[model samples]
Target: SVSVLSYAVIFAASTKLDITRKDSIKFICTFAILELVIELLYISYYERKKMISLLKGEK
Candidate 1:
């Protein structure tokens, strides 16, 4: 998430610096895809851990 946000900020700044439209679009799409993947992985890991704890009567 942090990485995604950082990339977005950098991309925005780069646009102001006169970066090409195509490059900006590419960067934004790449970061968005990466962010989605990271979030999915995180959610899956968290849910699995929570389920394990519940089954063990730890929560």
Candidate 2:
């Protein structure tokens, strides 16, 4: 995924800088978690109509 790739790039860049190892890991993990939550909400919202029709037995 683009997010994973971007996180990889960010981690690599951060490691190259003077930032501590723990901070870089923390930053990457935070972004990854936020992305996951956002994607889940977005998927549920966009698929709400389809889910409702299926629940009602619509074709």
Candidate 3:
């Protein structure tokens, strides 16, 4: 889950120059969603690695 304040900051920064509500909302939503997906993928990879290590008795 992306932090709310971070999302707001992102939304604010993107629209600070243009002052357009639509553009800012679009940019923020896209970025936040992408970041959330990437974080989930990273977590999945780490969990899988841990499981593999445990199976091999290396941890």
lDDT for model 3: 0.85
lDDT of 1 by residue, 1-59 (tens): 88767887978786897779898888788878987999999999999999999999998
State which candidate has the highest lDDT: 2
Worst 10 residues of 3 by lDDT: 11-20
Kindly report which residue pairs in candidate 1 clash with one another. Answer: none
Candidate 2 residues 1-59, lDDT tens each? 88768998999999999989999999888888988999999999879978998999996
Off by over 4 Å in 3: none
lDDT tens per residue, model 3, 1-59: 44888887787678668668887888878987898899999999999999999999998
| Cα lDDT for residue 16, candidate 2 | 94
Off by over 4 Å in 2: 52-59
lDDT of each: 0.86, 0.90, 0.85
- Residue 9's lDDT within candidate 1 is 94
Q: Indicate whether candidate 1 or candidate 3 has the larger lDDT.
A: 1
Residue 41: error of model 1 in Å?
A: 0.8
TM-score of each: 0.72, 0.70, 0.77
How many Å off is the CA of 24 in candidate 2?
A: 0.4
